[model samples]
Every structure is written in C-alpha cells, then in structure tokens.
Target: MSRYETVIGLEVHAQLKTKTKIFCSCSTEFGKDPNENVCAVCSGMPGVLPVLNEKVAEYATKMGIATNCEINLKSVFARKNYFYPDLPKGYQISQFELPICEHGHVDIEVDDEKKRIGVTRIHMEEDAGKSIHSAADNASFVDLNRTGVPLIEIVSEPDMRSAEEAIAYLKEVRSVLLYLGICDGNMEEGSFRCDANISVRPYGQEEFGTRAELKNLNSFKHILKAIKYEVDRQIDLVEDGEKVVQETRLFNVDKGITQSMRGKEEAHDYRYFPDPDLVPLVLDEAWVKQWQSELPELPRDKRERFMVEYTLADYDAALITTDRTVAEYFEAAVKAYNGEAKKVTNWVVGELLPFCHEVESEACDVKLSPEKLAALLTLVDDGTISVKIGKDIFRDLCESGDDPAEYVKAKGLAQMSDSGELEAMVDQVIADNPSEVEAFKGGKKKLMSFFMGQVMRLSKGQANPGIVTKMIQEKLS
Candidate 1:
C-alpha cells in the first residue's frame, strides 16, 4: 500500500495573443532580434509611465468567463520587487490582492473519475525578459523582446492527487486557451508554461504536507515526470524521518530529477505594494458583458456537440475535438462528403493522424486539405478505388499534396469492381486451394477470409473488397 497521497497545484503562465506589450507599444511578437522589440517603457528606462493594454483585459476576461471565474469589475496592479537580471524594472507589475478574476474551477478526469480542480485566481501580468546562456563563450545574453509580453497567471488549488490528474487539468486548460484564440499554448516557444507545487501527505490527513515548487517543466511529459520524482522524493523523506525543505526546484530534464534552486520566499519577501504609477482599473459592466457575448464555443462544449450532431462515438468525438484545427478538419471533410461522419472520422483519425506523426507536425501543418480528402473518400464510396488503395492515396496526399483522383488514375489503381473479372479470380482461388475449400465445405467458415485474401492478392489489392467478398462467397457456396 502507498504511504502517502500526492497533492499538486500548477501555476500556468500563458502569453496572451496581443499584438503589443502589456504596458508599452513595443511589439509582443516572438522570435525577434534581441532588444530590437524593446522600448523605453518596456525596457524600464527612467521616467516612463505604463499604460494598460485594453486587449489584455479583454482576453483575460474571456478566459475568466470560460473557466467560470468571477469577473472583478475593479482590480489593482501591484509591484512585485525582484532582482533578476532579466527584470528590467527591478520589479514586475502584477495583480496581487485584487486580481482581475477569482474563484474559478477546471474539471479534469483521471481513471474515469471526474474531479473539479479549483482555480484559485487568474491575474494579468507582464512577462520578464529572457536570459540566454552560452556555455562555450562563458557569457549570458539578455533579450527584452519578451520583456513586456502580456501574460495571465492561472493559479490552481492543490487539488490534484497524482500526475495523471495534473496532466489532464493542464491539457484542458491548454485546450481552453487554444479555443479562445488567446494563446498558442506552445510550450517549446514559451507561449504556455507551467510550474508545479507538489507535496505528499499521509493518506486521509486533513493537513497539507511540505511542498516544493517545480519549475522548467515545459512539456506534458516533463510535467508528469517531474511530479512523479518530486512526490517520490518527498515520500521517501517522510519515511526516513527527515524533514522536507520547502523551496523552489528546477527539473533537470536530462537527469529526470529535481534540484533545489532557492529557498521559497513568502509574499512579504517580494515587498508587494500597489503600483503608484498606474491607476486601479475600473472595468465597465457593459464591456464585460460584451466580452462574454463574444466568447466562442469552448473545447468541452464542442466535444459534446460533435458527439451529438456528428453522431460520433464518445472516443471518436473526443479525439476529433481535441484540437481546434483537427476538429475543423473533421467537420470540413464531413461537410464536403455530405455527412458521412463516421467514414470521414475513420479516415482522418486512422490514416491522417499517423501520417502527421510520421512527418512531425500537427493537423494544421498537414498538406492534405478537406476538399481533397472529401474527393478521396468519394472514390472509396463510389468503388472507384478500394479502401486499401485509398489509404495509399492518403499517404501520397500527406507526402506530396497530390490530388487523390489524379494519383489513382495516373497509377491505374482503380478498384476491380467488374463482376466477371472478380468471379474468374475467385473460382481460380477455389480450385488452387482445394484443402482450404474442403475445410470450408466441411465447416470451417473462416476459410472464406483466406480465399478472399487470395483473391485480393490476385487482384493486386485493387479489387473492391465488397465486390470480391460477394463474388468469392457465391463461388464457394
């Protein structure tokens, strides 16, 4: 039996998809030259005032609404004083006491049991500049391009019991971010990032355990592994009668361990105080309502709709609606093919997904469009090509973006639906495989598949499987 229960909460910082920085007019675009996107306000030059970006508030409210957070009509920005080199201002302007949104929850399921994880608060803040290290040159560089990027910090309650639950929650949160068009949720590029505060308590205990905050876990796999390692480390400390220190730790992805970075600091250590330069934001009730009205159909709603309207199985619906682009691709193909939802689902999930994985990209980067996929499915439905050959054509579409019909015609890969030709091949297979035929006549009904395989092989896999099955069954009976 396990001795302890793991508890995890995540602090997710997602860079909002705004065109400009939170306070300054500097560009928020990623992958720009170091310091090129910086400005006097964002780079913290002397005597510059910061102005709020209206779009950041709008996006944050959209998220709060989506996550069921209460919109705080009035909120204040505070200065969190810190001394990291990347912090140009020697402090970060953030929301501390009065955040923009509060008391929300996100639902996640693990092992078929649904759990509601409470979101503590969602506050708007500005991102710090990045510090680039170079081991070869023994030097570090600073890039202020991301210095003033708008970010929303989503702090969750310590409600997760295991790594699986944590991952499920993160995925849902990321999906919501994507669906709202607020963030790209790209961990590689730091658009979306997570820091986990994890601890392990004795099972059934009401009090919480000593926790360590794990940072630098950029990917889902990294999150899972880091949580697992931290939990085990804490539990072992307890069993050994050693005290677990509360501190900040960094995940060493290469070594699969967490090392202490610094002692955890209390809120007072940062000297949190209201920013005197910026005025408290007073949001209009009408404006908040307008933002809510413009909210798009979120991922969970879209998943349920896909199951109902598309008449899809629960698994199919979940997989199709997991990503916005993939969901749109499924719907577009279904529409173009005139509502053959199940057929299109099969092709997209089975064939197109593997092709995407092979090419190291997502559905959005796919070269095959819905119109082409619809045309390919039409060929299979009309018996112009076997589903087997259509799979081959799907591969061609994935690789080269060629038209499916043109590929089939150019390669002479049309299905052999001609009854006379299939019948002759079926008879020849029956004669050549006398033992199998006798076994089938003697009661081995499964031998029909053996004969069908032979017929299909004889037809070079171009035979319409339906027609060949019918023709083969007739000759054998």
Candidate 2:
C-alpha cells in the first residue's frame, strides 16, 4: 500500500461498421489501395460539404440506450480545428457542447467486488487518416482511405481507483459493443483503441493532481503496462517535490516507457465553432423507440440468466456469456443434447472452446456445429465410446465435421464393455503386476489407479473405466 491514491479514466474510440463514410458516400472498407476509397468530400476538396450518415446516428443512439444513457433529442456538431498531415480537413467535425448521449454508466466486477463506473458522454466524430513512415526512403506518407470514417468516443469519469478496475470497466464496455453488433472490437486493426488519463494525489486529498494522457496503447497488455508505469512515475515526482506536468505522452512498445509527445491543449485552443454546412441532428421519438426495441440482451443480463436457467456456476456462466455467440452456442448444444446441462457445459467449455481459439475463429464460425457436438457427447452418454476416446477424436471431428457414431464404428474405437473380454484383460493386468496386486491387497488401495492405467494402456484407451475398476477390485480381493 502506498500513501497516494491513483485515479484513472479511459476514452475509447470504436469505429462503427458502416458501409460508407460518415459524411460522404465513399466506401468505409479497409485494406484497399492507398486512396482507393477517397472522394472529393472525404479528401477535403474546396467546394465539398459533408452530409450526415443516418445509419451512424442510429448506431450511436443504440449504443447510448444500451449504456443507460439519456438520449438527447437534438445535438450539435462543431469543428475541431487542428493541423496534421493525415487530417486533410483543417477542422474535423465532432460534438462538444451537447453530445448525443450523456450521463450513462456501466457495471464491472474486480476481485469479486462490483463497481459502477460513470460514462460522462458518448459522442460521434470522424476519424483521421493513417500516416505510414518508410525508413528506407526516410519519408512519411499519408493514406486518406480511413479519412471520414465514423467513430464514437466514449468518455468515462475518473471513477476507477486502480488499473484492474479500469481494465474491468473497459472489458465490460467492449463486450456491450460486441453484443450490440455495432462495432467489430478489433484492437490490433485499430477498429477499437483506448487512451488513458492518469493522476495521483494524497490519500485524503479532494483536489486532483496534474494528469498525463497516455497514447499509442494498442492492446490491453500495453494499456495495463502503461497505466502501472505512469502511476509510479507520478508518485515518484510527487515524493521528490517535483511537479507533474500536463501533456500527451506516447508509450514506446520496446522501451516500455512513456515519451512526451506534445503539450496537451484545452478546448479553447481548438477554436471550436458550429459547422456552417451541417445542421443540428434531431432524432425522432419513434426512431429512438424502434432502436430501443431492437436492442438485444446485454452481457450482464444474459450472464445472470444463464446462472438461474442452466444451474451453471458463476465461473462457467461468466465465461460462456462474455460473448453473445458463445452463449448462443451453449444454448443450442444443450437443446440438442437434452441431458445434463453441466455435461454439455463441460464439453463446450473444455473441448470446443480451446479448439475454436486455436483455429482463430468464433463459436458460430467453427466447422463443428452444436448438433454435431451434442451427437458426440451422446455417444459417451450411451457407453458406446469412452470419454477419453471422445476427447481424442474431437479435433478431427471439428475439422472434418464427421458423424460421431459412424466415425466410432468405422475406426473400431467402441468401449470394451463385454463381461468376458474385460474380465480377461483385467486378469492379465493383475497377473503381470503381481507386486502391485500384493500392494493393493496389503492396503495400498491407491494402487487401483495403477491397475486401471495398465488396463487402459492395453485396450488403447477404449476400455470402460467403470467396468475395469470393478473387475480389478474383485480379482485383487
């Protein structure tokens, strides 16, 4: 424990999945040739004017409703003036005075304690282009393809007291975006990114200390590392009687330290003014109601429901409900199996999830369907195949999408449950391991596992464990 308390707030930029740019008709598709998606409006031509994309408003409003925000009936767009090579337009259009959403909050759990973090606002804006630097040529290039892309910046209050709480809150927000199907939530591709503002003060101080904004935090690992490093730096400066300056710093991935980028600017520095071309956006009541109706069950609600409906433990329910697709997959598998929900939960969480992760795909996109997985589990339920054998062939079934019963029959991998055959195998194992048998009869009952291991090896993992255990006990007794 330290004498200072850490305060953290996150600003997240999530690129909306729209077919075209926010203010222009140019396609928003990524990974095309340089300037392939550019147009007169997006390129900032002299005579072009921007038109708001209706779909962008709908998406933003839906997010606001999902976060328990108050959807303002009318909002204004203002020009955020700045100078950069990637920003072709001298001023980027963003909302400042009255955003579309305000006064919202989301709940998160850290260390088994639930906390609600305040969402100050979620506002819409246009994204700037990319700047690519070529070391060989000793030059930098700008690609305007990403210019005019739609984004919503969710700003959180300084409600987090530690990095763990900040991360938990971020994950909760990302999960909501994913569940709403409004954003792709891809951190590596820049579709989803974060900027963290950190400050430190004495444990009882009410006033906040000078803060530093950290940028270039691409992934969660980098965010966590940056927060930890920045917190310590601020504390050291305070203890040494040095002032912590307010500025923007970039996190160097290799060095794992923050380097000052530039002095942080206040809103007045930008000279913000209402855009002359675009008018105030007034949302219709019916339109807002329609979006509200279409909102799907959020992650937290679904997680609680899974616990009561399926009798799942908290860990299993939380893992399954983290993503909407995985939850749907679990429900579909359970419906098809019509057996113990826990049994289906075990296979889905233990086997299917790992396989999907290894192949880099979602639960819905995996080659193995829920029905096929239920079929595989059914074979084990009926004693037609051993549990070990089912696990061994799971990967192959996921890849090939073969029928479980047919594959078991074709490969001669059925469990050895016949009385005479199992008895003989058990007898041979006892005769071979006489010392182990004597040990078991002499009260080293744990040796029963050793006998079972031998029988399983002899039968090539196809032995019925229950029957083998019974026969080994009788012979030894």
Candidate 3:
C-alpha cells in the first residue's frame, strides 16, 4: 500500500424525466433538430421572463425525500453567472445558498464492508445546451434543445477513501434514481453523469492536497478508470516535488489520462443572486407529504425485502432489485409461478437478465412478460420440458411470448420420459461405445455423464435425465 491515501467526492447530475423545460413549455426532448425545442425563454431571448415549472419542483422534492435529504420548506433559485457558447443566457438559473435538499446520505458497500457517503446537497438547476464540435470542419454548433432541461445535482461529501468506494457509492445512488423512476440513468446519453474531485494526502496529514476535478466521465467504467488515473497522477506530482494544480480537467478516454481544461472556479465567482423573476419555491407541507406518500420502495429497502421475503442470496437480491422494473418482474413472476422464489431467481438472473441487457431494454419493456416467464418456468418445473430444452427455447419464448406448454407441443419439444424410448436410447449408447460401457462397469462411473450426453443428444435435448440416468446405470452396472 502507498503511504498516501486518496479522497474522492462525486457530483452527479441527473436529468429529470419531465416532459418540458424547467422554466418554459418547450419540450425537453432529446435528439431534436437544432433549436427545434427552443423558445424565447429557453433560448435566452431578451425581455422574456421565466416561469418555474411546478413539475420540476415536484420532481426535485421527490428525489430529496428518496435520498433521505432534508427538504427545505423554501428554496431559492439563483442566477449562476458564466460565459459559454452553449449557455445562451450568459448566466444559468441554479440554486445555491438555499438548495432544495441538504444533509442526505447514501449507504454503499465495498468489499463486504458498509460505508455511508454523505450527500452534502442536491440542488435543482437548469441544463445548458450542447455544443457539438465539428472537428473536420473546424467549427462548433450549439443545440439549445437541452437548454432549461430540469436537473438535480447530487453533491457528495469528500468521504470516500478509494476508487472502489467511490464507484460503489455512485452505483448505489444511481440505483436509487433508477428505482424511483425519476431519472433514466442513461450515462451514455448524458441523462446521468458524474464528475470526480480527487485529492491525495499523506497518511497522517490533516490538510488536504490540492484537488483536480475530473469531467467527461460519462460512464461508470470511465469514472473508475479516470479516478484511478487521476489519483496516480497526483501522487506522482507530489513525489517529484511538484505542486498539484487546482484545476478542472477532462478525461482523455483514448489516452486514459486527464488533461487540464481550465482553472477551477470558486462559488463566489458565479456571483450567485436570487432571480427576481421567479419567486422563492415554498413547498407546502401537504405537498411534501403527498410526494412522500407516493414514494415507492427504494432500492435498499427492496433489496432487504427480497432477501427476507424471497429468501434470496444477497448477491441475487442485489441484482434483482437494482432496477425497479426487474424487481417488479421478479415479484410478478414469483406470484404467477407460485413456486420456489429461488427457481424464479435462477431463470431471471441467469437467463432473463442477459436477454434484457442484450436487447438494451428493461424487463418491463421486453416481450417476455412476467406471466409468460412464469409459465415457461412452470413447464421446466413440471418436467414437461427438460432444463436443456428450456434453455434452447428461451430465446424463442422471449421473442414470441408464446405459451410455453403450447410452444412445447407445437415444436414437439416435450421431455421424453417414456421408459421404452429412453431405454432404447440408453442401450444404443451402451452398444455404440463398448469401451466406455466396459469402463463404466470397471468403476469409471463418471462415464455415466458420457452416456447421458449421448442419450440427450439422441433425444434432441428432450430426454428426461432422471430416467435416462437410471436406465443407463441399471444396464451398465
């Protein structure tokens, strides 16, 4: 271990799943034509007064409650002054001194050890437009479609000590956002993105080393790699008797290094002042209560319930509960199957999840409905189809959403349990491989697997292994 320790804090910006801009009626749709979704308010036209979207405030409050944050009865929006081509207003409307949420925390587990990462604040802000650069043409274009999109910036305390801890904390927070159905958590499309603040100090030091803020970490894999790279880079500077610069850096994904973008700015640099056009957002107690009442079972709670109620292993429970749709699918399937929960878990985690990932869709959107999945698993459990046959037909089941029993009958895919048929296949295997049969009789009982494979192949993976094994053993023994 190195003598120095790494401290990391993350600022995650999650785009609200709202329909319109935070302060305007313009659509908050992604991938629209340039400026198509823009209006005078979002485009920063002169003399246009901004109107606060009630849905934005409500969404922000829901997130605050879900994260265990203290919901401020009154929060003020301030103009964050900045100059960028994408920021058409020359200043962005954001919350500073009186953010909507504060003093929240998320618990994360790293290497089987639990740690709580404090959420310093979750402030609501309006997003700036995208600046698409055309390197070939040596020009940049601004798309105001994303302007004024509602965002909640979740800032964490510098409580993490390692990259592993940082990643675990990020994943936990993202899981919560996904479970709440507030943010889509699509890191690739920038719905959810994180910036890392990294510093290294000696083992006994009380003061922190100069920190570098890493940006452009759009994915979790990139975040982990960037954090590790930045930590090592800072340590190298310190060891070489060079002072670390406090600056903003962008991760060069291809080079796997952080390059300085610009010097970091202090909060006072933004010249934060409350916007006069919009009144202070005062959330009513009744409204807060209603939002709180609407809160679904969060990820941690659902994970715990899965363990106790479903008797799932911790790892399996974590996988199922990571996404709300997947968790709901599991419960619905279990209820529909009305069988062992672990059995449903196996098909879910082992088969269904892989298909979901492959198709880049959630379980809720997939063709394999919970009832359909339950029916398929029921066929496997009832011995109507062998496990191997179930595996073979799973993709078809997922695509066609066909009744498993009906599909089996239509495809002639039922398990072959007849004594006469299985015995003939087993005898044929024994006759075909005399040396293997002799070896089995001479204490090479493991050759039973070899015969079983042949019999299963003859039946096209529909042979009932239980009866086939009994017949093969009786003949060979």
Candidate 4:
C-alpha cells in the first residue's frame, strides 16, 4: 500500500461590486423580483452590441496589483459556448486565452507556517443567470437578472496539501476583495463563490491524480468539510484498487455529500474563441499605476501593523483587521483616546461586536462610535464611574449615542470613589460577611472576592471595585 497526500486548488469567482451589470445597464442588485433587474442587453435580445464596463477593468487591475500579478497590457474576451436556460445569451462572454492578470500569489498562514499559494490567472467574465428549483414540485425556473454581471475568476495552482490550507487561502482572498472594495464578498448572496479542484496522490509522487471539481460550497466551514470529505473519498477509492473519476460535483450542504453534476469538461470542451462582438481591452502603464495607488494596506500588512502599533496579539489583530469597517472603527477609537489600547480593544471586541450582530449591522454602522466608546473608557479610567456602572452607561450610549460622563452624572451612576464613602460601605460588607472575613484572616485570602461581592451589592454596583477592595483590606487588617 502506498501512502497518499491530498492536493487541492481553488477557483474562486467573485462578483465585482459595481452599480450596474457588465456590458449592460441593468442594476446589479440582489433579491430583485426574478428578472426585474434585467434589460435588453442582459436578457440577450437581438441586435444589441455589448459595451464594456470600465469599472470592471479598474477593479480587475486593482486586484491584480494587490495579488502581485502581472497586468496584461492587452486582454481579450472570448465566447464560452454553452447552452443553459439561465444564460439568455447561450454563451458567456469571458476571458480565456488572455486574462487581465497572471502569475500572482497570496501568502496564507496554516499551522503557524506561512505558505505561498500561486495564482495561475485572474480573468474577467460575465456571469450566467441563476436557476431556482421549486420545493413544491419537480420544477425549475431561470432568472436572467444576474446574466452579464461582471466577475473575476481567480484560479490558483494545486499548492494546498490540506483542507486547512484551502480554507485559509479562501479567507485571505475574500478579505483582500473586501478590503479593496472590489467585491462585497457575501457568500450567501452569491457575490463571492468558490469551486475547488481536489485530488489525492502518494506522498512525494510527481504526477497528479484524477481531480474532482466541487461547487456550491458557500461558507468557510462547508469548504473545509467538503475538501476533507473529497480527499478521503479519493484516497479510499485508490486504496480499494479503484481510480478516482474526473467529474464536476455539487456539494449538498444539508446532506453533507458531493453529487456528480456532469463529466468534468476540459478547456477545449467549451470551444473558446475571442468574442467578435467586444473589442480587446487595452491597459496602459499609466492607467495601471493610477489604480495601484488607490490600493489600501492589505490584510497581512494591516494585521502586522495592528500588532506592532497597538500591542495586540496575532489573534486580536487578525480579528480587528478581518473587515475594513472593524479596522477603521478600532483605529478611530485608538485615535480618539490616547494610550487606552486595552480598554478600546475590550469594548470593540466585547460590546460593539455583539451589538453589531444583535442589530444585524456591519461594523461600519455600529451605533456606538469609536470616539464615544473611547470617552466611555476614559470615564472609567478617570474614576468618574465604576467599571460596572460604566458598562451600564455604555449600553445606554450604544442605544442613544449620549456622552458617557454626562450620562453618568445625569443618571447619578457615578462611582462612590471618595475614600470616606467607600470606607463606610466596606465596613458594612465586612460586618455582614463574618464567615468570609474569618476566611480571609485564616489565609483563605481568596475570600476577598466574597467581601467584594457584598460591597458591590450594598453599593448597588456603583462602588469603584478597586477602591472598595483596597479599603476593605486596609480596614480588615
């Protein structure tokens, strides 16, 4: 028996975030009435000449520069001939021989090791329409609304050895697209979709094995599972003296199985040819350089900077920089209040994150602005309010966007930080919890927590816990 290794490559199709469909004037909005966003060009009516969307080219160029790809000076669109009810044009206008980008790479961290995955090509293409299958009956319907929408298919080399690597690569790519504002990167809305090509071969084998293309893996978790299952399935076939067949398979997320869609179509199967209707795209050095300047700091660089500048750990930086909105929010909070890194991080990660999810909003729309959060943290730091009381005021600020210090004073929620006031409260707590006081005297110093709890309850959670604890220890001693 020969040992085997799994090899996987990914082909990710990301829809560019443009206002209108490529080559047409149709609105590129999702969830419109079926075909409501379609127009004559997108619907493939007769006698319409396809006009190129300039923004698509700019987006492609931006992605190419970001991924370290070579921008093709001239790229051509070709006719991918296929017949499907959803595709009104009967052929998708896409780049085949000459794509907008080539030979790029993205570095992904897997198992604490950074591995570079090679990007074979990134090509521009028009999307096909969507097909809707009815649950009530054995009926299927087609919607041409998405037809002629612009997409860039990023093809990666077979450089991944495990499912983790594949998912990391996918996440990194999605983050790049989102950071660039080129794609919304929504998997559920079909804005960013991924199809994987996977195979298994003996360890150190030079030749590759038969590969299966898996599609409809919408989420990151599903992608990981699908790749793992496919790898196992292929290895099992080889072990049982069977050969893995080359085919296109669809992942049934609910069933957790891959079903064959069709025999895998080779490149020649589509009979690719330069589209006669549209002219070749020509990009100059000046044009490419202009788009390059617009590129922001990508995920890797941003993550490192966050770690260095804010003294955050790798996980914290990764979480903060995963989305552009979160990163901006964090930076704003840091700027608003000087040298309160940990406080800002706690509120952003703990309170703001859950609040965003609760209201079903992106981080960009977080009701508690970074300046406001910083102000709240400052209130706690300056002893204007206890940490517990600050949290309550912060929640009110999140709801009403009011000033934290003013809210605390107006609501009489300020901490009893005066030594005289807290001393009296500490005495009451010590008298009430005699067992805890005895325990503390007997060297079970952890009973300090019990005394602290009683103090908090007596103060109605308005006492400064640090002051109360210190005053209690002094009085008890």
TM-score of each: 0.93, 0.97, 0.98, 0.95
For residues 312-357, what per-residue lDDT tens digits would candidate 3 score against the true structure? Answer: 9989998999889999999999999878999999999999899999
Q: What's each prediction's clash count?
A: 0, 0, 0, 0
Model 4 per-residue lDDT tens digits across residues 8-41: 9999999999999889888998888988998888
User: How do the residues 46-106 of candidate 2 rate in per-residue lDDT, one tens digit apiece?
Assistant: 9888999999999999999999999999999999999999999888899999899999999
Query: For model 1, how does the per-residue alpha-carbon lDDT over 310-381 read when each residue is reduced to its tens digit?
Result: 899877877777788889888888888964689999998898877876886778777788888999989888
List where candidate 1 sits over 4 angstroms from the true fold. 357-367, 398-403, 427-450, 474-477
Model 2 regions more than 4 Å off: none
Each prediction's RMSD over C-alphas, in Å, is 2.2, 1.3, 1.1, 1.9
What is candidate 2's CA lDDT for residue 402?
89
Model with the higher TM-score, candidate 2 or 3: 3
Candidate closest to the true structure, highest TM-score: 3
TM-score of 1: 0.93
How does candidate 2 fare on TM-score? 0.97
Residue pairs clashing in model 4 are none
RMSD of model 1 against the true structure: 2.2
